[model samples]
Target: MQTVNLGIVAHVDAGKTSLTERLLHATGVIDRLGSVDAGTTQTDTGEIERRRGITIRSAVVSFTVRDRQVNLLDTPGHSDFVAEVERALGVLDAAVLVLSAVEGVQPHSRRIMRVLRSLGLPTLIFVNKIDRAGARVDELVADVRRLLTPTVVPLGTVRAPGTPGASYRPHPRGYDQRLAEVLAEHDDDVLAALVDDLPLDGDRVDEALRAQVAAGQVHPLLFGSALSGAGVPELLDAVAALLPPSPPAESDPRARVFAIERDPSGERVAYLRAYGGQFRTRERVTAYRREPDGRTTATRGRITRLDVVGAATDRAALTAGHIARVVGLTGVRLGDQLGSPAGLDGRSHFPAPTLEAVVRPREASRTLALHAALLDIADTDPFLRTRVAPDGGTSVLLYGEVQREVLSSTLVETYGIEAEFGPGRLMHVERPTGTGTAVEIIGHGFFGTVGFRVEPGDGVDYRREVELGSLPLSFHTAIEEAARAALDQGCHGWPVTDIRITLTHSGYWSPITTAGHFRDLAPYVLMQALAEAGTRVFEPCRRFDVEVPADRLGPVTSYLSRLGARLDGTAAVPAGWRIAGVLPARLELEAQRRLPDLSSGEGLWSSTPGGDRPVSGEPPRRARTDGNPFDRVAYLRFLAQPPSRPVAVRDAGPERGHRSPR
Candidate 1:
């Protein structure tokens, strides 16, 4: 049998979870239907998810449908937990976009559709809640066509009378009038058949639709009520009959681990999508994981367990186009590429970690333990980054206030570690303002000394140049790697970015000063170089895409002005105007908060962090620290660190009231 990885996605309360439940029960994957309201759904196994009645993590369940074994991913609909959705998208062969017939196309759904298009995944539109009163399928389709894809066509007749226990047949008039034109536009053969005939044969239509869908030029629209089990069987049949099977995983041996989980016994489980060869249990694998140095390494681990998702049996081997759980990989992380990576980057456009907060244990004695635990949590959720302070306090990056609350609760209930986070703040980075050069020397019998010139970059390159007299060619890699690590954090507390470090001169004694010594001392030397180079603050900016009516362009531009946005340009869109620009990320939130009112409920907006922009209105201030590289006393104080303490945590509810520590 063929394999398919289908993702069911939607805006909150659009019946995405409900659709999953109906599909599972309808396909006999489960005996009874579970309810999201009742908190009894099979895939939402997390305690918090069950109680909150929302999916926080993407979960999988498998079923055989239409002659294919399909692994269905139920993704989180809440925009706050969108990272979860993005992770699942990386493994999807195709997607089912769930939209409400009554509520129509929502903002989050449109945002998701944008990403789906960018990834070029075949998509099927399921207009759910057809049985609901006041549902307007035509209006919903129009919104979908206007905002998402214009080529979306209705696949089968909805609400038409047919023989009981038989398949849904397309209404000849609807098919000839709407879908036929769409198919004809895409395939000359289909157009020939349509012109030469009256009504399209179902098989011919299915073949043409599948071809276009796979090409991502057309998306089939199906209508249904997942709750009433109305039109669900047709949706299932459409997926099985119209969608293409995934590319075989056995073609390559590489797999990407998109998520990580812990079993009840605390054994780590990694959710992997085999892009290539088969994975056998007890096989020693060469794993490649992205490191802090921004490179992948050969971290070897043995796979001790292999189980198909939602299946009871443990399989000795798993192949491509399959999602499975494996254990005993000690060094794997959320985006690690297993089995040589085979030219896979394993990096997606993950949302930047913008919110920063200080964390400490409620008990002062567990300071070091608390710090370690925070890093552990960050490893699981890459969006969360940890910063350790000299005072034994730790800080973390977060998405929003609710995420902060969720992290606090998880720390307490899951890890048995209670912690409180300071109020989250916008994370800002720093960069050098002017060019400068500095030198570090090893006296007497020591091996070598290094000199570097640091300067601001034009945003295209951040590199290290080796000038003449740079030790042996083999030693350059060690020095380059060390210099990059040192540049990670600049003169200010913020991370350093967009700067070029050139090796102006090198004096080395090859015998004593090994690569290890150069690697160890390069950071200290680089720090001094950056300090002499001088530094300035840069705030995070977001790139915005907005669409509104032509008449509403004035109000939109007016709103952007208030948000301190620099308008890149605007173009004519079918609905109205398409505006693009860069704006302060802080104001991006403000824009989100007030968009409905500004757009009068008819506008669409999306944004992603666009990296750092220099302080425009005000003279930029420098990041402050007590023992920074510029301060020699503090630099010496850094050498004697680490007298740990136990920590204490207080329950700060969903809305964190504190600010990140200075």
Candidate 2:
């Protein structure tokens, strides 16, 4: 049977979980429906999720639909948990974007659609909650077209019994004929049929619709009320009938680890979507992940166990077009390529977190335990960044107050350590002002002279383009890796971005200088190059859309302008104006607090991270590490430490973790 991986996603409280529950019930996967509020959800099996009535981790379940096996991944709805959604997307055959009929298209819903298009994932639009009071399927459909895509066409509409429009209907297989002209504009076959006067009934239109949706050229919008089960059956049928199918498997066995979880037995479980061939228990596979020093280390491990879509344990192999939970990869991480450990093309789509906090246990003795516990559970919410700062302080990046609370509660419940967080500070990054080089010799318990040239540009992480023959493969690899790791923090506290570096010299005795020497001191020399370049800090900015009463436009504009904002444009809305602009990310929170007062509670705002701009008021962030690379005494002082000490994590870029949802 053909298998399809479908993800259900939406903004917070848009009825994503409700939709998942209704799907399972409609498909008969469960005996009865589960409620998100009652913590009775099947996919939301995590304690944190059940208690909070939200999904923090992606959960998978399988059911057979129309001779096809469907592996449904329920993704977290809150933007705070977007990393969870990104991980889910990497393995999905297609996606379903759930939106509230009453609220229309929300800011997050639009952002998710944009991301879905960027990834080239075929999508189906479902306008949910049509039974709710004030639900306007027409307006919602229009918003989906305007904000998401022009090709979106409704399958059908929902109206209350005795109401003015079409009443609620189920199993309506016929395509709305009025939309055929629009379909003809995109589908050649449909246009050919129309031009030739070929008889086109619901069957012909159905064929056209299926072909278009499978090709991703057109998206069919369906109206539904998950709460009342008004359109649940049709939605299920549409999922089985409309979305694209997985491509034929390649000859070679291939898969990518998209999420990582640890079992209570201390076994490392990896969630992966197979792309080709099959993976069997006891099969040896190459694993790829960045070491703490930033090098892509390759290792081989035997698959100790394999669980494919909750199949029988006797099932020994997982074929292509399936999702599996396997154990025995000690080092695999989110986005790790399975076939070749040498592949570095694997990348994570999660955005950089914008807020950070220093977290410390109330009992100082539990510091190590706190770090270890946080690292383990941190995968539940990948954006909840837990990293050791350059100053040896442990910190976490959060989405907002809810995340901080969740982290604290989770830490206490899981790790048994009471913790508190320091005030949150907006994340900042710096770029080099100009080109600079470091060639001076500096050694710490090793012998070698390292140097690199630093230049500023667009890419976020470090890229090496050095002559391979200049050094041995291992030494060359270590230099590139160490140099990238060194950029974790510039001479300033903010993370650094958009830089190019190339190795210039490695002066040392080839036989005498160990690879460890290059890895350990490359950061020291790179810091020298960065200081020479004289960096400038860039503050985080956001692109915003603020909806306000038309008469109150002046008040909102004046308010945003004072917060160092530059208005991009403004459009008229039914009740107000949709003023769009760019502003510091910090100002967005303040606007949320003050806009209601200024607009007399009629303002709504949405924002996404924008490119950084030069700092206007804040000074350059201070470096926590010793500033001078040539200072041997201070450099050695920083390097000498206990064996258990975890080095400051390198700047190789973001890595996401998988969660068990505990």
Candidate 3:
């Protein structure tokens, strides 16, 4: 049987999880359909997700259709969970992007579509909730074409007889019209045959459409009401007929590490997608680590187990064109690829974390435990990056609030360690604005002095990259370490951004200066130099998508203007107005609270941090009230009083309310 890995993505409330359950039931993988409203969806297994009636993480499940195995990855739709969707995309062969017939294309949907295009993955569009009233299929399709991609063409339509709030059934004629359009676009010959009014065969049309889809030239759009199971069988048939199978290969040894997890037995498992080559059990493979020196070293590890999809037992050897779990390798980090000859570069192209928070254990004794638990979680999800601040605080980089909550829950449940989180913060680095000199003096007559210039670099978003070399390796390492430490405690206790530093020449003691001594003193000297040279703070900004009722549009625009946000654009959604804009991070919380109030609870907004910008404008002014008349009168009398005159020599000795001069 052929196997295909596909992902289902959509905006929140677009019926993604519900559609997933319907697909499962239609394929006989499940006995009954699970509902997201009831918190019983099979894919949303986490307690937090079930309770909230939303998917927090990506869930993978396997089922069969038309004698072909289909592995489905159900991903979260909320923008906060974008990292989950990104991770799921890395291993998917293709994607099914679901859209609401009434809502059309939303901000989240557009974002995911951009991601899909970036990855160069073929996609299918599922227009769900067509049974709802006022569901304009033609209008939604047009909006999708304008916003998402023009390649998405409807395969069939669903006709329902009702008003905006009535139940309806799918009309067969509408479905046939859509199918004919799809078939006509599949190939030139098919189009000609359809135009000539000649009979077309279903099997031939399916084959042609599958070929077009696999080539990424077109996306077949289908409509379905996952609730009523309308057109579900046709959707399943498309999944089996249109999705491409994995190409066969013989031991080419190229695989991507899509995810990392820990088994019940506590062993780390790296989920791998082998595009080519057979990975045999007990075979030694070389792994390479990316290092700063540009030298990669190969380490060998034996694969103890190889488990593949549809395998009945553990004895089966995993081959190419399969998602498999390989174990028995230690020292392998998440996102690291394993292969022969050991020097091949295997890296996961995931986005950097957007938000960060500091984590510390409630009990000091559990610090080590908390650290270990965080590392494990980070391993499982490469999107979470952990760094230790110079002040001994642990900082965790997260995607958003949902990830923050998940980390908190994992800490409490998995490790039995209680921890507290500081406010979400942005990471900034210090760069030089101009050339400056710094001097480091070691204990007992050892000194190192260096001349460096900090300036702007090529990267527009980052503060700047530090470029310095030609000095002794020991001294250079110390200087780099010092620069990093200086950044941790920025000039005014805030992180620095968008600046670069270059190290020129340095003077060092030949006999007495040591690396350790320089390392200890370099940071202080760097801090002093930065203070003398001057540095500025940078703040993060976000790209916000705000939706409000048409009547509340004026209030929404006014609120955004007051918050110092810039309007990108606006569009008319099904039941509301969508305003896209950018706002500073400091104003995000306030905007979130005020938007709903301004729109009378009819407005909704989502935002993602959009890099840092140079700090601008002066701080806000303080307010003061008028003083009382008594205080004013006292002030006037004090001002009118003459200054005390100098006393004579004899009188200077002592006086009432006066000091004596000797």
TM-scores, one per candidate: 0.84, 0.89, 0.73
Q: Best lDDT goes to which candidate?
A: 2
Q: What C-alpha lDDT, on a 0 to 100 scale, does residue 182 get in candidate 1? A: 91
lDDT tens string, model 2, 1-662?
A: 78889999898889988888888888788988899989999988768889999988788888877877788899988877777787788889999999887788887788888888777677898888777777886667777877788889787657672223334564355645556777797778778877897767888887777777776768878887777777677777888888877778877778878777667776778888887878888899987764433347677888989988844223677777888999987767776767755335545555667888888889878888988888877644445667665545578887778778877887887679999788888888888889878764644356877767888866544554445675677887687766766666775556677777767766667588878888877877677677777678888889888889988999889988987899999998776789989998877778889988998998888888776788876444533443233354445655775545544433211111111110
| Model 3, C-alpha of 160: deviation from truth (Å) | 3.4
Q: Backbone collision count in every prediction?
A: 22, 2, 11
- What's the C-alpha lDDT at position 248 in model 3? 70
lDDT of 1 by residue, 1-662 (tens): 78889999999889899899999999998898898888999888878878778887788899888678889999988776777787788889999999987888776787788888888799999987777766766667777998789998976655532222222344543345567689899889778867887666767776777798887788888887877777788788888877889885555588878777788898988889887778888999988876544555778999998886745323667777888889989778777788866645545555566777788899987777887877777666666677665346787777777677677777887877888776667877777888877666765322567677888874313354555345776566677787776554565456777687777656677476787666655665666677667777788888888888778899889988877899999988778888989998878767877777767788887776577688766433323332344434444354344334212212211022221111
lDDT of 2: 0.75
Candidate 2: Cα lDDT at 513: 81
Residue-wise C-alpha lDDT for candidate 3, range 119-186, written one tens digit per residue: 76778988888777667677787888777877776766556622333233333332244555665665
Worst 10 residues of 2 by lDDT: 653-662
Best by TM-score: 2
